[model samples]
Target: MAAQLVRAAKTESKGKPERLRFYYYTAGSGGAGPTILATSFLLLGEEVVAYNKGEKIKLKPYSGMLNIDFGKGIGKRDVYLLNLPEVRSAHDVLGIPTVSARFGTAPFFWNWGMSAMTNLLSPEFLKDRTKVQQLVQLFDPLVRAVDGIAGERVSMRVDLECTDGRHTLGLFSHRKLSISVGNATAAFALAILEGSTQPGVWFPEEPEGIAIEARELLLNRATEGTINFIMNKPPWMVETDPKELGLGIYVLQFRTQVVEITDLSGGFDLALKAADCSEVYSFEDIHENRKPPQ
Candidate 1:
């Protein structure tokens, strides 16, 4: 079937303003695609491919996915991030609440699943003042309880007395070290931890567009690919106020190395000027050896 522009926005510039258009599509091979059944809610919701509540959609026909075009004027911060269920419901459903309500803090001190379920079943278990006080007292005495247990087994303890008490230490008194690592692996780890966050290594700057494609990929499990797009800036902005124009690179490292990039048609254009550019001479370029095919 043909692609549908499910959401579209067009804004013109007296000056520049961001505009975005979102589209979704599906395709199937050999035979016609599965039928989409529409559903309606009390208030009109965003259009969704209609499917019966309990109907199962086959894996093959639903493969063709969406393409998000965050128009030229969009900013990185302006992007709205949503999970699949939230995106499917068009943000009507609040799937998961914050950790503070379910657990006790922003970075939860307990297992998320257990704490979330506990709060889901009994709402006030973490929220109520009395319950929190009781938990604090119970956890307060856990230190002493652990100290009294004498055994040859391994033990771990959290002392909540530090000024910034969130710090944790792993102790392994009877541990043995036999893990093998070469020199290259050791140096790479050091470089990533020490070098990347420093100014000389990498620069952090504001990005140009709303990267909704990555968010969509996260939500819908889109296939592996590198997405690129161009943003056309006004002549005045490009020539006079380059920094104010705020053009920079934002690299999204793969969870796993992208074995291949499926499409590169949407790539953004960059106008590099010699005035602000630096040149470097490389002493050596690193190369990898590929294994021969069987």
Candidate 2:
């Protein structure tokens, strides 16, 4: 199937894209019983992967399984930093020079049966038709609620908030996170495939053309809800929260939209560039368990 996609991608124009300060945020749905059951591997113990100057580096992650009070939209659920195998192949195998690669998700606070469900749910294990029916009955609400979830509406969003020098805090480009759009990675993937001129197969690992197109898709994408405040600038410039963000990190929050954002900072106090995270993370020398994105 992957080979078929590669053949399909050959017709399109290939490119070298540098999408730094990337992040994935989720909200609204996805914390239900069915959703958690589907995406367990991505959430558990996965670290966000970044490729810079041909080095595959691991970024920081949130502590334990649940956020005590820090999670923005997930509400005491799980938001995990991820390392997609395809992204790794893009750099390691394809040798596509990558500025960055990242992904994250805020699953609607974990469902009650999250841990156990992950351990179970197999075709071989649950062979009986009775089990399948019972399982569907349990997650019927979640399945019915999501058609599933927003399509173009974007319940899951990927932010390519890269600057000449860029950094990230956990899943967001900014240290003090806020609510944004969610889910449309499926649409994004389909766009790449449907955009294909000739019939062939493709995998998640991007060819040059697919990588370039993916970067273009991520640019200036607005979420479904309307908002006045935006975080398009480099993390430090946007005055969001005035509290303990990052070194020189400014903040602003938008709850689903630009409503009651916590630590919403309007202006900034002029200060020297004492010590910034993006400055350090922007470089390539800090790999191999060295000082990384914090």
The list of candidate 1 runs beyond 4 A from truth reads 1-109, 112-121, 140-257, 260-294
lDDT of 2 at 276: 29
Clashes of 2: 18
- Supply the global lDDT for candidate 2: 0.35
Residue 168 lDDT (model 1)? 16
Relative to the true structure, candidate 1 reaches a TM of 0.18
Expressed as tens digits, the lDDT of each residue in 183-268 for candidate 2 is 23443555557663223554444443344455334423322232222333222322223233555343323222121112223322
The TM-scores of all predictions, comma-separated, are: 0.18, 0.39
Ten contiguous residues with the weakest lDDT in model 2: 281-290
- The per-prediction tally of clashing pairs is 3, 18
What lDDT tens digits, residue by residue, belong to model 1 across residues 180-210? 1122244334444543223343211101111
| Native-structure RMSD, model 2 | 12.0
